[model samples]
Target: MASGVDLVIFGATGDLSRRKILPSLGALVARERTKLRVIGAGRSHDTTDQFRELVKEASGNPALAATAEWVTLDYADPASFAPINALITGTAVVIFYLATPPETFSPILVAIANSAMVTKGDPSRRVVLEKPLGYDRKSAKELNAQLATAFDESQVYRIDHYLAKDTVQNVLAFRFSNSLFEPVWNRNLVETIQITVAEEEGIRQRAGYYDQTGAVRDIFQNHVLQLLALVTMEPPTTFDPDYVRRAKRAALRAMSPLDVTSAVRGQYEGYLDEPGVSLESRRETYAAARVSIENWRWDGVPIFVRTGKALRRRATEVVIKLRDAPLDR
Candidate 1:
C-alpha cells in the first residue's frame, strides 16, 4: 500500500463501473482530490486506449475522459494484477473495486492474494465486494469464511449501495444521536417497517442472468435485508467496529428463518413469452415476503420486502411506519 491511495476498478468497462463509478470518481478528481489514482481493469479485450475512450464517453465528461487510465487486466490472472500493484506503490491505499458477478469473486480474491496485491503487512490495503454475496444463507457463510482466510474482517468492506443513501444514514443518526427518537425506536414505539424496491421494466436483455437469480437472490437477500437491519438494529454501545457489527449481526440472526409460506414468488407470463426468454425457466420475476424478528425490540413487527422485473414504475425507497404518534386531542 502506498501513502496516499489508488482505486483499481476490476470491471471498469462494465455497466456499473462506467455509469456510476467513473462519473463519481471524476467528480472527486475534478474537485482536486486526485490523490486517488484509478486503474480500470476488466475482461474486455480492449487495449488501454480503447478502454480509456470507453470510460470517457460513458462518463460523459470530457475532462474526466482525458485523465482516465485504462488497463487490460483479467481478474483471474495473477500476472495481470501486477500492474495495478505497480501503479500505487509506496504506502498508498489500495482499494480493489470488484464490479463483477458474485461467481467471479473467489477466483479474483485468490489471484489478488497470490499477486502481492493484498499486502499482509500493510494496514491500508482494502478490497470492496459488491452484493449478491451468495445465492442463499449457506453460500453466504461459505463466501464469508473464504474471505476471512485472507483478509481480516476489518479489511473487507461489503458494499451494499442502498446503505449509502442519505435517508438510511439519517436513520442511524436520528435514532442514536437524539433522545427524542431512541425511547420510541423499538417494537413498542414502532409499528412495522416496509422496504420496497420496485421496478417496472421486465427482464429484457437480463433474461439469461435474471433467470438464475430471481428477485430473492437479486435484491432481497442483500439489499432489502441490509435496509431491514439498519432500520431495526439496536444502537451500538459505541461507534467501534465490533460493537456496530455485533448489533447488526444480532438483528439478522433475530429474523425468523424464512419459510416458503411466508413469502410469495411470481413470474410474469408475457416476460417469458418475450422474444428471447425461454418458456421453461424457473426464475421468479417478482417476490414479496413478510418477515418477523424474534427480538424484544421488534418481536411482533413484520418487515416486508418485494421486488420484481418487467412491469410498473421504477422507484426505490423505504417506508417506516412509526407507532408513537401524538393524539389529536
Candidate 2:
C-alpha cells in the first residue's frame, strides 16, 4: 500500500475471481484498503454495488469487501470500456489483471491499449497475464509479441501461482542460503532427479479448456518447467531477481529438444465422459518426461518430470535421488 492505484481484474465473475484472486487481494490490503482502488470488470450485468456485495461474500471479511468496486463490460460494445478507461487515466500503478481464458486475452489487451486516454508508454501501467498464455510454442511467441506492443518487458508480469506457495519459497531459502548443497548438487552425487505435481480431482468444470490443453500445456508449460528450473538451476552470482531468473532460464534452455523415447502421455479413465469433452479426444490427461540437461554439471543425469489429473495421490515436490555409496562387500 505504498501508493494509491487502480487494481483492475478483467474476469471478475469467473470462478478464479471468487475462489482465490479476490480473497488474496483482500488479505493483501486489509490494513491499507484506501491505497488500492479494486475494480472488477466482466461481461456480466452486475452493477458496481451488486458486484461489491459479491466481493464481500467472496472475501469473507467486511474490510476486504469494501475495497472492491465493479464495472460492467461487454466485449462487443465499445461503450463498455468507458468505465475502465476513466479509471486508468493518470494512474500511479494500474495492476491490470486478465483472469479470464486465454482466448479472451488478446482482444482485452487490444481494447485496453486502444481505449486508454494516456500514452502506452505510461510507466505506471502493467498487465499481469495468467497461466497458459497460449495453446503451444508458436502461439506463445505470438502472444508475447502482441503483449509487448502494449507494455514493455518490465511492465508485464506473467504469474505462476504455484511459485507463491510457502513450500516452494522454503526451497529457495534452503538452496541459496546454505552453501553445503552446491558441493554435491550435481551429477557427481545426484543419480537422478524427480519432480512430480499431481491432482486428485478430474476435469470438473474446466473440460472445455482442459480437453484442449491437457496435462502438457496446463501443467508442464508453466508449473512443472518452473519447478524443474528452480531445483536444478545453477547457483546465481547473486540472489537478485534478474540473476535468479537468468539461472532458471539457463537451466531450462539446457534441456531443449526433449527426447520422446523417455516420454509418456496418457488419458485418465472416463475422461471422455466429462462435460464438454469429445468422445474421440486424443488429448492426454497425464504427461511424464525424462528431461536430460546437456550441461557440464548435469550431463548424464536425467530429471523425471510428471504431472496428471485424477491421480491417486496429490503431491508436489522436487526429489534428488543420490548415487549409492561404493563399498567393499
Candidate 3:
C-alpha cells in the first residue's frame, strides 16, 4: 500500500479475471484513475513480462497491463503467500478480491489471516468475495464465521456484479427519491414482483463447477435474492451505507420461509451431455421460487424469483405487477 490503495485480484488466471475484472480495470485505467495500484496473483509461473502480455491479450489494452505487477504461487501451499506479503508495502489500504471459487475462499482467507495482510481489526485491509457465498444458511454461516476470523464485517464486501447494473443500482433512487411511489409501494397496489435472470449460453466449459452449483446455488442464492431484497427493503432512515444495509437486513429477515411445494428445479434438455457432466446428474440449470415477505408493507405480495441457463433470453430483469382496480371487472 502507498498513498492510494492496492487492489489484489486472486485467481488472476481464471475466467473471471480474463473476462470481467481485467477488462473492467483496463477501462478504468483508460479513464481518470491514477493513484490506485493493481496486482494480479495466481498460480501462473509466467514471468512478469509474460503475465503482462497475457493481461494485454485478454484485455486488449497494453497500458493497463503495463501498470500491473504479477505474483505467482501454488494456491495449495499457504507458505507461498510470502511474495504477496512482500508486495504489501506502505500504509495505504490493501483490498483482496477473492476472484476464485467458493471452495478456495476458506483456504485463501486462512492463508491471508496467517499472513500480515490482515491484522486485528485492520480497516486498511478489506476482502471482496464474489457471488455464490454459500449453498445454504448453514454453509453460509460457516463461511461467515471463517471470514470473521480475518476481518470485520465492514472489511468484507460480498459482491454480486448484477447488483451493480445501472438499472438495479437505481432501485433506491427510483423508489425513495420519488414521493409518489413510496406511498403506493405496498401489497395493496402491487400484485407480484417477478425477478428473472436468464442465461442463453449452456454450460460451455463450466460443467464441473455448474453441476455442483446449479441455478439455485449459483444465481438464486446471491443475485436473485439481492434483487428481491432491493424490491422488498423498507425505506432507510437515510441513504447512507449503514442505514441502507440495516434496512436490507431487516427486509431479508422478514422474507417468507421456503416451501418445497412452491419450489421448482429443472435441467436443460442437453445438460446431461455437457462435457465433464455425469449422466446421472440431477443438477438443475433452472430454479424458481415464490417468496412472500411477511412485513407491514408487503404482507400479501408474492415475490417470484427465477433463474435459468440455456434458456430463451440472456437477460436479468425485475418486473413488478400492479393490482387491478376494483372496477376493472
Give the 10-residue window scoring lowest on summed lDDT in candidate 1.
59-68
How many clashing residue pairs appear in each of the predictions shown?
Answer: 10, 0, 1
Reference-based TM-score of each model: 0.83, 0.90, 0.90
Candidate 1 local lDDT, 54-117, one digit each (tens): 7677666556566456667766677877776677667457788888877788888888888777
lDDT of 3 by residue, 173-236 (tens): 9898999888889988998989999999998878757888888888887788778888889988
Instruction: Report the number of backbone clashes for model 1.
Output: 10
Superposed Cα deviation of residue 93, candidate 3 (Å)? 3.7
> Native-vs-model 1 lDDT?
0.76
RMSD of 3: 2.3
Of 1 and 2, which scores higher on lDDT?
Answer: 2
Least accurate stretch of 10 residues (summed lDDT) in model 3? 29-38
Q: Candidate 3 clashing pairs?
A: 1-89
Off by over 4 Å in 1: 1-4, 60-63, 73-76, 80-91, 177-182, 202-209, 268-270, 273-279, 322-329
Weakest 10 consecutive residues of candidate 2 by summed lDDT? 113-122
The lDDT per prediction is 0.76, 0.83, 0.84
